[model samples]
Target: MTAVHGDPILTSEEGPIRTTEFESIARAVDRETEGVQVELIGGRLGVKRVPDGDHGRILNWLLLLLMPLNPGLFLHVIGQGLAVGSYRKGRARPDGILAPPDAFAGAGEWASPDAVVMTVEVTSHDSDTNHRDRVEKPIAYARAGIPIYLLIDREAGKVVVHSQPDEDGYQDLHSYAFGRAVSLPEPVGVTFDTESLKDMGD
Candidate 1:
Protein backbone atom coordinates (compact mmCIF):
# COMPACT_ATOMS: atom_id res chain seq x y z
CA MET A 1 0.00 0.00 0.00
CA THR A 2 1.08 3.57 -0.67
CA ALA A 3 1.98 5.85 2.24
CA VAL A 4 -0.17 8.67 3.61
CA HIS A 5 0.86 12.28 3.87
CA GLY A 6 1.37 14.70 6.82
CA ASP A 7 2.27 11.93 9.26
CA PRO A 8 4.44 12.65 12.25
CA ILE A 9 8.18 11.85 12.09
CA LEU A 10 9.15 9.56 15.01
CA THR A 11 12.74 9.09 16.19
CA SER A 12 14.44 7.54 19.20
CA GLU A 13 17.90 7.41 20.83
CA GLU A 14 18.36 4.11 19.02
CA GLY A 15 17.33 5.44 15.57
CA PRO A 16 14.06 5.27 13.66
CA ILE A 17 11.84 3.17 15.97
CA ARG A 18 10.87 0.45 13.45
CA THR A 19 7.40 1.40 12.04
CA THR A 20 6.90 5.00 10.85
CA GLU A 21 4.18 7.41 11.86
CA PHE A 22 2.58 7.22 8.42
CA GLU A 23 2.47 3.43 8.60
CA SER A 24 0.82 3.57 12.02
CA ILE A 25 -1.61 6.25 10.85
CA ALA A 26 -2.41 4.18 7.82
CA ARG A 27 -3.13 1.19 10.05
CA ALA A 28 -5.38 3.33 12.24
CA VAL A 29 -7.23 4.74 9.25
CA ASP A 30 -7.57 1.29 7.75
CA ARG A 31 -9.01 0.00 11.00
CA GLU A 32 -11.54 2.84 11.06
CA THR A 33 -12.58 2.47 7.42
CA GLU A 34 -12.21 -1.22 6.63
CA GLY A 35 -13.55 -2.27 10.02
CA VAL A 36 -10.71 -4.75 10.41
CA GLN A 37 -8.88 -5.79 13.59
CA VAL A 38 -6.58 -2.96 14.59
CA GLU A 39 -5.05 -1.57 17.78
CA LEU A 40 -3.62 1.89 18.33
CA ILE A 41 -1.79 3.99 20.96
CA GLY A 42 -2.48 7.73 21.06
CA GLY A 43 -0.80 10.18 23.43
CA ARG A 44 0.57 13.71 22.91
CA LEU A 45 0.11 13.05 19.18
CA GLY A 46 3.62 11.54 19.04
CA VAL A 47 5.19 8.54 17.36
CA LYS A 48 6.09 5.21 19.07
CA ARG A 49 8.45 2.80 17.38
CA VAL A 50 10.87 -0.07 18.13
CA PRO A 51 13.82 -1.27 16.15
CA ASP A 52 14.55 -4.80 14.87
CA GLY A 53 17.34 -6.12 17.03
CA ASP A 54 18.36 -9.32 18.79
CA HIS A 55 16.71 -8.21 22.03
CA GLY A 56 13.43 -7.18 20.43
CA ARG A 57 13.19 -10.24 18.22
CA ILE A 58 14.06 -12.66 21.00
CA LEU A 59 11.60 -11.23 23.51
CA ASN A 60 8.83 -11.03 20.92
CA TRP A 61 9.31 -14.64 19.88
CA LEU A 62 9.25 -15.80 23.47
CA LEU A 63 6.01 -14.00 24.24
CA LEU A 64 4.29 -15.32 21.11
CA LEU A 65 5.34 -18.83 21.95
CA LEU A 66 4.11 -18.71 25.53
CA MET A 67 0.77 -17.04 24.76
CA PRO A 68 -0.83 -20.18 23.38
CA LEU A 69 -0.38 -22.01 26.67
CA ASN A 70 -3.11 -19.76 28.05
CA PRO A 71 -6.03 -19.71 25.62
CA GLY A 72 -8.18 -17.73 28.01
CA LEU A 73 -5.88 -14.72 27.80
CA PHE A 74 -6.18 -12.29 24.90
CA LEU A 75 -2.85 -10.50 24.93
CA HIS A 76 -1.40 -8.08 22.41
CA VAL A 77 2.22 -8.76 21.47
CA ILE A 78 3.11 -5.16 20.62
CA GLY A 79 6.72 -5.69 19.66
CA GLN A 80 8.16 -2.63 17.96
CA GLY A 81 4.71 -1.07 18.10
CA LEU A 82 3.83 2.36 19.46
CA ALA A 83 3.21 3.91 22.92
CA VAL A 84 3.28 7.67 22.54
CA GLY A 85 3.67 10.51 25.11
CA SER A 86 5.78 10.98 28.29
CA TYR A 87 9.39 12.02 29.00
CA ARG A 88 11.01 9.09 27.20
CA LYS A 89 9.66 10.07 23.79
CA GLY A 90 10.02 7.77 20.76
CA ARG A 91 8.89 4.44 19.37
CA ALA A 92 8.38 1.82 22.15
CA ARG A 93 7.00 -1.57 21.46
CA PRO A 94 6.82 -3.53 24.70
CA ASP A 95 7.91 -7.20 24.79
CA GLY A 96 4.19 -7.91 25.02
CA ILE A 97 1.12 -6.25 26.44
CA LEU A 98 -1.48 -8.28 28.38
CA ALA A 99 -4.67 -6.58 27.27
CA PRO A 100 -7.85 -8.67 27.49
CA PRO A 101 -10.66 -8.44 24.91
CA ASP A 102 -13.49 -7.66 27.35
CA ALA A 103 -11.93 -4.31 28.27
CA PHE A 104 -13.78 -2.54 25.48
CA ALA A 105 -17.47 -1.78 25.18
CA GLY A 106 -18.47 -3.15 21.76
CA ALA A 107 -17.35 -6.30 19.98
CA GLY A 108 -15.57 -4.50 17.16
CA GLU A 109 -11.98 -3.45 16.40
CA TRP A 110 -9.53 -2.53 19.15
CA ALA A 111 -9.19 1.08 20.23
CA SER A 112 -6.18 3.08 21.39
CA PRO A 113 -4.62 3.46 24.84
CA ASP A 114 -7.92 4.70 26.24
CA ALA A 115 -9.38 1.26 25.61
CA VAL A 116 -6.31 -0.43 27.03
CA VAL A 117 -6.73 -1.82 30.55
CA MET A 118 -3.06 -2.76 30.91
CA THR A 119 0.38 -2.74 29.23
CA VAL A 120 3.60 -4.79 29.63
CA GLU A 121 7.22 -4.20 28.68
CA VAL A 122 9.99 -6.77 29.14
CA THR A 123 13.42 -5.35 29.56
CA SER A 124 15.77 -5.42 26.59
CA HIS A 125 19.56 -5.97 26.50
CA ASP A 126 20.35 -2.33 27.00
CA SER A 127 19.11 -0.44 30.02
CA ASP A 128 18.26 2.33 27.57
CA THR A 129 15.81 0.00 25.85
CA ASN A 130 13.49 0.04 28.87
CA HIS A 131 14.01 3.68 29.75
CA ARG A 132 10.58 4.59 28.42
CA ASP A 133 8.71 1.61 29.87
CA ARG A 134 10.30 2.06 33.29
CA VAL A 135 9.52 5.76 33.65
CA GLU A 136 7.63 7.53 30.90
CA LYS A 137 5.42 4.67 29.74
CA PRO A 138 3.83 4.26 33.19
CA ILE A 139 3.38 8.01 33.48
CA ALA A 140 1.76 8.18 30.09
CA TYR A 141 -0.43 5.14 30.76
CA ALA A 142 -1.63 6.61 34.04
CA ARG A 143 -2.25 9.98 32.40
CA ALA A 144 -4.37 8.26 29.79
CA GLY A 145 -6.25 6.56 32.67
CA ILE A 146 -5.16 3.03 31.86
CA PRO A 147 -5.74 0.93 34.98
CA ILE A 148 -2.63 -1.25 34.98
CA TYR A 149 1.00 -1.48 33.84
CA LEU A 150 3.45 -4.41 33.99
CA LEU A 151 7.20 -4.28 33.66
CA ILE A 152 8.89 -7.66 33.39
CA ASP A 153 12.58 -7.67 34.07
CA ARG A 154 14.32 -10.42 32.20
CA GLU A 155 17.56 -9.70 34.01
CA ALA A 156 16.04 -9.71 37.45
CA GLY A 157 13.47 -12.43 36.87
CA LYS A 158 10.77 -10.32 38.47
CA VAL A 159 7.49 -8.78 37.36
CA VAL A 160 6.33 -5.41 38.67
CA VAL A 161 2.68 -4.46 38.64
CA HIS A 162 1.35 -0.90 38.78
CA SER A 163 -2.28 -0.05 39.30
CA GLN A 164 -4.62 2.65 40.58
CA PRO A 165 -3.71 5.62 38.43
CA ASP A 166 -3.65 9.00 40.06
CA GLU A 167 -2.14 12.44 39.41
CA ASP A 168 1.33 10.82 39.36
CA GLY A 169 1.44 7.47 37.63
CA TYR A 170 0.08 4.36 39.40
CA GLN A 171 -0.58 4.65 43.13
CA ASP A 172 -0.03 0.94 43.86
CA LEU A 173 3.05 -1.07 43.02
CA HIS A 174 3.54 -4.82 43.54
CA SER A 175 6.16 -7.35 42.46
CA TYR A 176 5.88 -11.02 41.60
CA ALA A 177 8.28 -13.81 40.75
CA PHE A 178 8.22 -17.03 38.79
CA GLY A 179 5.79 -19.83 39.81
CA ARG A 180 3.55 -17.19 41.33
CA ALA A 181 0.11 -16.36 39.95
CA VAL A 182 -0.85 -12.75 39.27
CA SER A 183 -4.43 -11.59 39.59
CA LEU A 184 -5.76 -9.02 37.13
CA PRO A 185 -8.70 -6.79 38.00
CA GLU A 186 -11.19 -5.10 35.75
CA PRO A 187 -12.89 -6.54 32.71
CA VAL A 188 -12.98 -9.06 35.62
CA GLY A 189 -11.80 -12.62 36.47
CA VAL A 190 -8.49 -12.47 34.56
CA THR A 191 -5.37 -14.15 35.91
CA PHE A 192 -1.86 -14.60 34.47
CA ASP A 193 0.13 -17.77 35.01
CA THR A 194 3.62 -16.30 34.92
CA GLU A 195 5.39 -19.62 35.53
CA SER A 196 5.24 -20.28 31.80
CA LEU A 197 7.40 -17.23 31.34
CA LYS A 198 10.11 -18.72 33.57
CA ASP A 199 11.58 -20.43 30.55
CA MET A 200 11.80 -17.15 28.62
CA GLY A 201 15.15 -15.64 27.61
CA ASP A 202 16.92 -18.81 28.65
Candidate 2:
Protein backbone atom coordinates (compact mmCIF):
# COMPACT_ATOMS: atom_id res chain seq x y z
CA MET A 1 0.00 0.00 0.00
CA THR A 2 1.12 3.57 -0.66
CA ALA A 3 2.15 5.39 2.47
CA VAL A 4 -0.68 7.14 4.22
CA HIS A 5 -0.17 10.88 3.91
CA GLY A 6 -1.05 14.23 5.45
CA ASP A 7 -1.01 13.13 9.10
CA PRO A 8 0.12 16.16 11.05
CA ILE A 9 3.38 15.82 12.89
CA LEU A 10 3.17 15.17 16.61
CA THR A 11 4.85 18.19 18.15
CA SER A 12 5.47 19.07 21.77
CA GLU A 13 3.92 22.08 23.49
CA GLU A 14 7.09 23.21 25.29
CA GLY A 15 6.47 21.55 28.62
CA PRO A 16 8.23 22.65 31.76
CA ILE A 17 8.39 19.03 32.86
CA ARG A 18 10.05 16.10 31.12
CA THR A 19 8.39 12.79 30.28
CA THR A 20 9.73 11.29 33.50
CA GLU A 21 8.20 14.03 35.60
CA PHE A 22 4.96 13.70 33.72
CA GLU A 23 4.74 10.08 34.78
CA SER A 24 4.83 11.00 38.44
CA ILE A 25 2.28 13.74 37.96
CA ALA A 26 0.09 11.55 35.81
CA ARG A 27 -0.08 8.91 38.51
CA ALA A 28 -0.90 11.44 41.19
CA VAL A 29 -3.67 12.91 39.07
CA ASP A 30 -5.11 9.51 38.22
CA ARG A 31 -5.14 8.66 41.86
CA GLU A 32 -6.81 11.93 42.84
CA THR A 33 -9.24 12.33 40.01
CA GLU A 34 -12.60 10.58 39.82
CA GLY A 35 -13.64 10.39 36.20
CA VAL A 36 -11.01 12.09 34.05
CA GLN A 37 -7.85 10.47 32.70
CA VAL A 38 -4.51 12.19 32.16
CA GLU A 39 -1.93 11.60 29.46
CA LEU A 40 1.43 12.82 28.20
CA ILE A 41 1.33 13.11 24.45
CA GLY A 42 3.80 14.88 22.21
CA GLY A 43 5.68 16.06 25.30
CA ARG A 44 2.54 17.81 26.52
CA LEU A 45 0.00 17.08 29.25
CA GLY A 46 -3.57 16.26 28.26
CA VAL A 47 -6.84 15.36 29.96
CA LYS A 48 -8.82 12.55 28.41
CA ARG A 49 -12.47 13.36 28.71
CA VAL A 50 -14.74 11.40 30.98
CA PRO A 51 -16.46 9.00 28.64
CA ASP A 52 -20.13 9.60 28.05
CA GLY A 53 -22.73 6.86 28.04
CA ASP A 54 -22.62 6.62 24.30
CA HIS A 55 -18.86 6.55 24.35
CA GLY A 56 -19.02 3.48 26.54
CA ARG A 57 -21.67 1.93 24.35
CA ILE A 58 -19.28 2.17 21.45
CA LEU A 59 -16.63 0.25 23.34
CA ASN A 60 -19.10 -2.36 24.51
CA TRP A 61 -20.18 -2.80 20.93
CA LEU A 62 -16.60 -3.55 19.99
CA LEU A 63 -16.18 -5.92 22.92
CA LEU A 64 -18.84 -8.23 21.55
CA LEU A 65 -17.30 -8.40 18.11
CA LEU A 66 -13.68 -8.66 19.21
CA MET A 67 -14.01 -11.40 21.80
CA PRO A 68 -15.82 -13.99 19.74
CA LEU A 69 -13.59 -13.55 16.69
CA ASN A 70 -10.22 -13.37 18.41
CA PRO A 71 -10.18 -15.79 21.30
CA GLY A 72 -6.45 -15.56 21.88
CA LEU A 73 -6.47 -11.80 22.30
CA PHE A 74 -7.95 -9.84 25.17
CA LEU A 75 -9.08 -6.27 25.44
CA HIS A 76 -7.59 -4.35 28.33
CA VAL A 77 -9.34 -1.26 29.48
CA ILE A 78 -9.27 0.21 33.03
CA GLY A 79 -6.86 3.00 32.20
CA GLN A 80 -4.18 0.90 30.54
CA GLY A 81 -1.52 3.53 29.92
CA LEU A 82 1.13 2.64 27.38
CA ALA A 83 4.66 3.86 26.81
CA VAL A 84 4.24 5.17 23.27
CA GLY A 85 5.75 7.48 20.68
CA SER A 86 9.43 7.76 19.76
CA TYR A 87 11.75 6.36 22.40
CA ARG A 88 8.72 5.86 24.64
CA LYS A 89 8.68 9.55 25.49
CA GLY A 90 4.92 9.75 25.22
CA ARG A 91 2.39 8.11 27.56
CA ALA A 92 -1.08 7.43 26.21
CA ARG A 93 -4.05 5.61 27.70
CA PRO A 94 -5.88 4.04 24.82
CA ASP A 95 -9.57 3.34 25.34
CA GLY A 96 -8.91 -0.34 24.70
CA ILE A 97 -5.69 -2.30 24.22
CA LEU A 98 -5.62 -5.68 22.47
CA ALA A 99 -3.09 -8.10 23.88
CA PRO A 100 -2.78 -11.49 25.46
CA PRO A 101 -4.36 -12.08 28.84
CA ASP A 102 -2.05 -11.03 31.69
CA ALA A 103 0.11 -9.24 29.15
CA PHE A 104 0.42 -6.32 31.54
CA ALA A 105 1.18 -8.52 34.55
CA GLY A 106 3.59 -6.96 37.07
CA ALA A 107 3.84 -3.84 34.92
CA GLY A 108 3.50 -0.33 36.19
CA GLU A 109 0.98 2.33 35.28
CA TRP A 110 2.38 2.78 31.77
CA ALA A 111 3.16 -0.62 30.31
CA SER A 112 5.22 -1.46 27.25
CA PRO A 113 3.57 -2.12 23.92
CA ASP A 114 5.84 -5.04 23.10
CA ALA A 115 3.04 -7.63 23.24
CA VAL A 116 0.24 -5.35 22.25
CA VAL A 117 -1.30 -6.02 18.84
CA MET A 118 -3.70 -3.11 18.59
CA THR A 119 -4.84 0.05 20.39
CA VAL A 120 -8.41 1.24 20.15
CA GLU A 121 -9.62 4.82 20.40
CA VAL A 122 -13.23 5.94 20.51
CA THR A 123 -13.74 9.63 19.86
CA SER A 124 -15.55 11.52 22.58
CA HIS A 125 -17.78 14.52 22.21
CA ASP A 126 -15.11 16.95 23.26
CA SER A 127 -13.12 19.69 21.60
CA ASP A 128 -9.79 17.92 22.04
CA THR A 129 -10.84 14.79 20.14
CA ASN A 130 -9.49 16.19 16.89
CA HIS A 131 -6.00 16.72 18.20
CA ARG A 132 -5.89 13.87 20.71
CA ASP A 133 -7.68 11.13 18.80
CA ARG A 134 -7.34 12.06 15.14
CA VAL A 135 -3.95 13.69 14.68
CA GLU A 136 -1.56 12.91 17.52
CA LYS A 137 -2.79 9.45 18.63
CA PRO A 138 -2.28 7.68 15.27
CA ILE A 139 1.23 9.05 15.15
CA ALA A 140 1.88 8.15 18.76
CA TYR A 141 0.57 4.58 18.43
CA ALA A 142 2.37 4.13 15.13
CA ARG A 143 5.61 5.31 16.63
CA ALA A 144 5.14 2.74 19.37
CA GLY A 145 5.24 0.05 16.66
CA ILE A 146 1.75 -1.20 17.42
CA PRO A 147 0.66 -3.40 14.51
CA ILE A 148 -2.84 -2.00 14.24
CA TYR A 149 -4.69 1.10 15.42
CA LEU A 150 -8.49 1.08 15.31
CA LEU A 151 -10.30 4.35 15.52
CA ILE A 152 -14.06 4.57 16.07
CA ASP A 153 -14.61 8.14 15.11
CA ARG A 154 -17.74 9.51 16.69
CA GLU A 155 -17.62 12.90 15.08
CA ALA A 156 -17.13 11.54 11.58
CA GLY A 157 -19.36 8.49 12.10
CA LYS A 158 -16.71 6.19 10.62
CA VAL A 159 -14.24 3.49 11.55
CA VAL A 160 -10.60 3.90 10.49
CA VAL A 161 -8.21 0.98 10.56
CA HIS A 162 -4.49 1.79 10.56
CA SER A 163 -1.85 -0.84 10.02
CA GLN A 164 1.71 -1.46 8.83
CA PRO A 165 3.46 0.72 11.35
CA ASP A 166 6.87 2.28 10.86
CA GLU A 167 8.90 4.91 12.63
CA ASP A 168 7.35 7.67 10.55
CA GLY A 169 3.71 6.47 10.73
CA TYR A 170 1.25 3.85 9.62
CA GLN A 171 1.66 2.82 5.96
CA ASP A 172 -1.95 1.77 5.36
CA LEU A 173 -5.18 3.58 6.21
CA HIS A 174 -8.63 2.16 5.51
CA SER A 175 -11.79 3.96 6.57
CA TYR A 176 -15.38 2.70 6.52
CA ALA A 177 -18.58 4.55 7.07
CA PHE A 178 -20.80 3.60 9.96
CA GLY A 179 -22.94 0.48 9.40
CA ARG A 180 -20.46 -0.70 6.79
CA ALA A 181 -18.40 -3.82 7.45
CA VAL A 182 -14.80 -2.82 8.24
CA SER A 183 -12.03 -5.36 8.13
CA LEU A 184 -9.03 -4.68 10.35
CA PRO A 185 -5.65 -5.79 9.01
CA GLU A 186 -3.39 -8.58 10.23
CA PRO A 187 -1.67 -9.13 13.62
CA VAL A 188 -5.11 -8.48 15.10
CA GLY A 189 -7.51 -9.40 12.38
CA VAL A 190 -11.17 -8.79 13.22
CA THR A 191 -13.84 -7.44 10.94
CA PHE A 192 -15.99 -4.75 12.57
CA ASP A 193 -19.76 -4.48 12.37
CA THR A 194 -20.41 -0.85 13.10
CA GLU A 195 -24.14 -1.02 12.53
CA SER A 196 -24.97 -0.50 16.19
CA LEU A 197 -22.83 2.64 16.17
CA LYS A 198 -24.81 4.18 13.34
CA ASP A 199 -26.96 6.29 15.68
CA MET A 200 -24.57 6.54 18.61
CA GLY A 201 -21.61 8.93 19.37
CA ASP A 202 -23.75 12.02 19.26
Candidate 3:
Protein backbone atom coordinates (compact mmCIF):
# COMPACT_ATOMS: atom_id res chain seq x y z
CA MET A 1 0.00 0.00 0.00
CA THR A 2 1.01 3.62 -0.55
CA ALA A 3 0.52 6.78 1.46
CA VAL A 4 0.09 9.71 -0.87
CA HIS A 5 0.60 13.36 -0.05
CA GLY A 6 0.42 15.70 -3.01
CA ASP A 7 2.31 14.21 -6.01
CA PRO A 8 4.76 12.00 -4.12
CA ILE A 9 4.22 8.41 -3.02
CA LEU A 10 5.29 6.77 0.28
CA THR A 11 5.55 3.28 1.64
CA SER A 12 6.91 1.60 4.82
CA GLU A 13 10.19 -0.24 4.37
CA GLU A 14 10.11 -2.10 7.71
CA GLY A 15 13.36 -0.26 8.49
CA PRO A 16 14.67 3.29 8.48
CA ILE A 17 11.97 5.06 6.45
CA ARG A 18 12.08 8.63 5.14
CA THR A 19 9.53 11.29 6.07
CA THR A 20 8.59 12.39 2.55
CA GLU A 21 8.00 8.84 1.44
CA PHE A 22 5.72 8.25 4.43
CA GLU A 23 3.71 11.43 3.78
CA SER A 24 2.97 10.45 0.21
CA ILE A 25 1.72 7.10 1.40
CA ALA A 26 -0.51 8.72 3.97
CA ARG A 27 -2.33 10.85 1.39
CA ALA A 28 -2.76 7.90 -0.96
CA VAL A 29 -4.38 5.53 1.52
CA ASP A 30 -8.13 4.94 1.10
CA ARG A 31 -10.20 7.22 3.27
CA GLU A 32 -12.80 4.58 3.76
CA THR A 33 -13.18 3.89 7.45
CA GLU A 34 -15.67 5.96 9.38
CA GLY A 35 -13.42 5.99 12.52
CA VAL A 36 -10.20 4.45 11.28
CA GLN A 37 -6.92 6.35 11.62
CA VAL A 38 -4.73 6.24 8.51
CA GLU A 39 -1.10 7.06 9.20
CA LEU A 40 2.27 6.67 7.50
CA ILE A 41 5.78 6.61 8.89
CA GLY A 42 7.26 4.67 11.85
CA GLY A 43 7.50 1.10 10.55
CA ARG A 44 4.25 -0.70 9.68
CA LEU A 45 1.57 0.21 7.17
CA GLY A 46 -2.13 -0.35 6.56
CA VAL A 47 -4.56 0.00 9.47
CA LYS A 48 -2.93 -0.48 12.87
CA ARG A 49 -5.55 -1.19 15.49
CA VAL A 50 -5.60 -0.69 19.24
CA PRO A 51 -5.96 -3.79 21.39
CA ASP A 52 -9.77 -4.07 21.09
CA GLY A 53 -10.83 -6.72 23.55
CA ASP A 54 -13.44 -6.30 26.31
CA HIS A 55 -11.23 -4.09 28.43
CA GLY A 56 -10.23 -2.20 25.32
CA ARG A 57 -13.87 -1.45 24.58
CA ILE A 58 -14.52 -0.21 28.08
CA LEU A 59 -11.46 2.05 28.03
CA ASN A 60 -12.48 3.36 24.63
CA TRP A 61 -15.93 4.22 25.93
CA LEU A 62 -14.39 5.99 28.90
CA LEU A 63 -12.19 7.98 26.57
CA LEU A 64 -15.25 9.04 24.60
CA LEU A 65 -16.80 10.12 27.88
CA LEU A 66 -13.86 12.48 28.41
CA MET A 67 -15.15 14.76 25.65
CA PRO A 68 -17.68 16.71 27.80
CA LEU A 69 -15.20 17.35 30.61
CA ASN A 70 -12.43 18.98 28.64
CA PRO A 71 -13.89 21.11 25.86
CA GLY A 72 -10.36 21.58 24.55
CA LEU A 73 -10.01 17.82 24.54
CA PHE A 74 -10.61 16.22 21.13
CA LEU A 75 -11.17 12.52 21.01
CA HIS A 76 -10.08 10.43 18.00
CA VAL A 77 -11.69 7.08 18.47
CA ILE A 78 -10.15 3.60 17.95
CA GLY A 79 -8.52 3.67 14.50
CA GLN A 80 -7.95 7.35 13.65
CA GLY A 81 -4.50 8.51 12.56
CA LEU A 82 -3.09 11.40 14.58
CA ALA A 83 0.04 12.50 12.75
CA VAL A 84 0.82 12.00 9.07
CA GLY A 85 4.59 11.82 8.52
CA SER A 86 7.63 13.51 9.99
CA TYR A 87 9.48 11.13 12.29
CA ARG A 88 8.08 7.62 11.99
CA LYS A 89 5.95 5.41 9.77
CA GLY A 90 2.62 3.63 10.36
CA ARG A 91 -0.67 4.74 11.87
CA ALA A 92 -1.24 4.00 15.55
CA ARG A 93 -4.77 4.40 16.78
CA PRO A 94 -4.65 5.47 20.36
CA ASP A 95 -7.72 4.74 22.42
CA GLY A 96 -8.26 8.51 22.58
CA ILE A 97 -6.23 11.54 21.64
CA LEU A 98 -6.45 14.69 23.82
CA ALA A 99 -5.48 17.68 21.70
CA PRO A 100 -5.64 21.25 22.97
CA PRO A 101 -7.64 23.93 21.12
CA ASP A 102 -4.66 25.51 19.40
CA ALA A 103 -3.57 22.13 18.10
CA PHE A 104 -7.03 21.55 16.67
CA ALA A 105 -7.73 25.15 15.62
CA GLY A 106 -6.48 25.25 12.03
CA ALA A 107 -8.72 24.17 9.15
CA GLY A 108 -6.54 22.07 6.88
CA GLU A 109 -3.85 19.61 7.95
CA TRP A 110 -2.50 21.02 11.21
CA ALA A 111 0.78 19.28 11.94
CA SER A 112 1.91 15.86 10.82
CA PRO A 113 -0.66 13.11 11.43
CA ASP A 114 1.59 12.12 14.32
CA ALA A 115 1.67 15.65 15.70
CA VAL A 116 -0.52 15.14 18.70
CA VAL A 117 -0.46 16.79 22.11
CA MET A 118 -1.14 13.62 24.05
CA THR A 119 -1.32 10.00 22.83
CA VAL A 120 -3.06 7.39 24.96
CA GLU A 121 -2.80 3.64 24.70
CA VAL A 122 -5.31 1.61 26.68
CA THR A 123 -3.87 -1.82 27.22
CA SER A 124 -6.10 -4.85 26.76
CA HIS A 125 -4.79 -8.34 26.02
CA ASP A 126 -1.29 -7.49 24.94
CA SER A 127 1.11 -9.99 26.46
CA ASP A 128 3.95 -7.55 25.94
CA THR A 129 2.80 -4.19 27.22
CA ASN A 130 6.32 -2.99 27.99
CA HIS A 131 7.41 -3.68 24.45
CA ARG A 132 4.79 -1.40 22.93
CA ASP A 133 4.97 1.28 25.59
CA ARG A 134 8.65 1.42 26.53
CA VAL A 135 10.37 0.25 23.37
CA GLU A 136 8.64 0.67 20.00
CA LYS A 137 6.43 3.67 20.83
CA PRO A 138 9.26 5.64 22.39
CA ILE A 139 11.18 5.41 19.14
CA ALA A 140 8.14 6.44 17.12
CA TYR A 141 6.83 9.34 19.25
CA ALA A 142 10.26 10.56 20.31
CA ARG A 143 11.30 10.84 16.69
CA ALA A 144 8.05 12.69 16.01
CA GLY A 145 8.54 14.82 19.14
CA ILE A 146 5.20 13.99 20.67
CA PRO A 147 4.77 16.01 23.88
CA ILE A 148 3.27 13.45 26.19
CA TYR A 149 2.49 9.74 26.34
CA LEU A 150 -0.23 8.15 28.47
CA LEU A 151 -0.51 4.43 28.87
CA ILE A 152 -3.39 2.82 30.74
CA ASP A 153 -2.96 -0.79 31.75
CA ARG A 154 -6.37 -2.27 32.43
CA GLU A 155 -4.99 -5.57 33.65
CA ALA A 156 -2.74 -3.90 36.19
CA GLY A 157 -5.19 -1.05 36.80
CA LYS A 158 -2.43 1.48 36.33
CA VAL A 159 -2.00 4.72 34.42
CA VAL A 160 1.50 5.69 33.43
CA VAL A 161 2.54 9.03 32.02
CA HIS A 162 5.73 9.52 30.05
CA SER A 163 6.05 13.24 29.46
CA GLN A 164 8.67 15.39 27.77
CA PRO A 165 10.52 13.49 25.09
CA ASP A 166 14.24 14.05 24.89
CA GLU A 167 17.08 12.72 22.76
CA ASP A 168 16.81 9.30 24.35
CA GLY A 169 13.21 8.64 25.37
CA TYR A 170 10.57 10.16 27.64
CA GLN A 171 11.97 12.32 30.44
CA ASP A 172 9.30 12.63 33.10
CA LEU A 173 7.56 9.46 34.11
CA HIS A 174 4.66 9.16 36.59
CA SER A 175 2.36 6.31 37.52
CA TYR A 176 -1.07 6.53 39.11
CA ALA A 177 -3.60 4.14 40.48
CA PHE A 178 -7.39 3.81 40.18
CA GLY A 179 -8.65 6.73 42.26
CA ARG A 180 -5.88 9.11 41.33
CA ALA A 181 -6.02 12.05 38.92
CA VAL A 182 -3.32 12.75 36.36
CA SER A 183 -2.67 16.31 35.15
CA LEU A 184 -1.68 16.68 31.52
CA PRO A 185 1.10 18.93 30.22
CA GLU A 186 0.77 22.69 29.90
CA PRO A 187 -1.39 24.99 27.67
CA VAL A 188 -4.30 22.88 28.87
CA GLY A 189 -3.29 21.39 32.29
CA VAL A 190 -6.33 19.19 31.99
CA THR A 191 -6.56 16.66 34.82
CA PHE A 192 -7.35 13.29 33.32
CA ASP A 193 -9.68 11.34 35.53
CA THR A 194 -8.42 7.83 35.91
CA GLU A 195 -11.38 6.93 38.06
CA SER A 196 -13.71 7.00 35.10
CA LEU A 197 -11.83 4.44 33.01
CA LYS A 198 -13.33 1.12 31.92
CA ASP A 199 -12.83 -1.21 34.88
CA MET A 200 -12.01 1.53 37.35
CA GLY A 201 -15.57 1.96 38.56
CA ASP A 202 -16.78 4.73 36.30
lDDT of 3 by residue, 1-202 (tens): 4322221132346645544554554455545423223444346443343344665565566566666766766755534455522344444545666665455445343245434777777654434445554565655665567777777767667777888876577888888886688776654466766666535422
TM-score of each prediction = 0.55, 0.90, 0.63
Predictions in order: lDDT: 0.53, 0.81, 0.56
Displacement of residue 171 (Cα, Å) in model 2 is 1.5
Using TM-score, give the best candidate's number.
2
Which candidate would rank higher by TM-score, 1 or 3?
3
Q: Give residue 83's lDDT in candidate 2 (0 to 100).
A: 95
Worst 10 residues of 3 by lDDT: 2-11
Error of 1 at 91 (Å): 6.3
- Candidate 1 lDDT score relative to the true structure: 0.53
**Candidate scoring better on lDDT of 2 and 3:** 2
Q: What's model 1's TM-score?
A: 0.55
Scored against the true structure, residue 180 in model 3 reaches a CA lDDT of 86
In order of TM-score, best first, we have 2, 3, 1
Q: List per-candidate RMSD values in Å.
A: 8.7, 6.7, 6.5
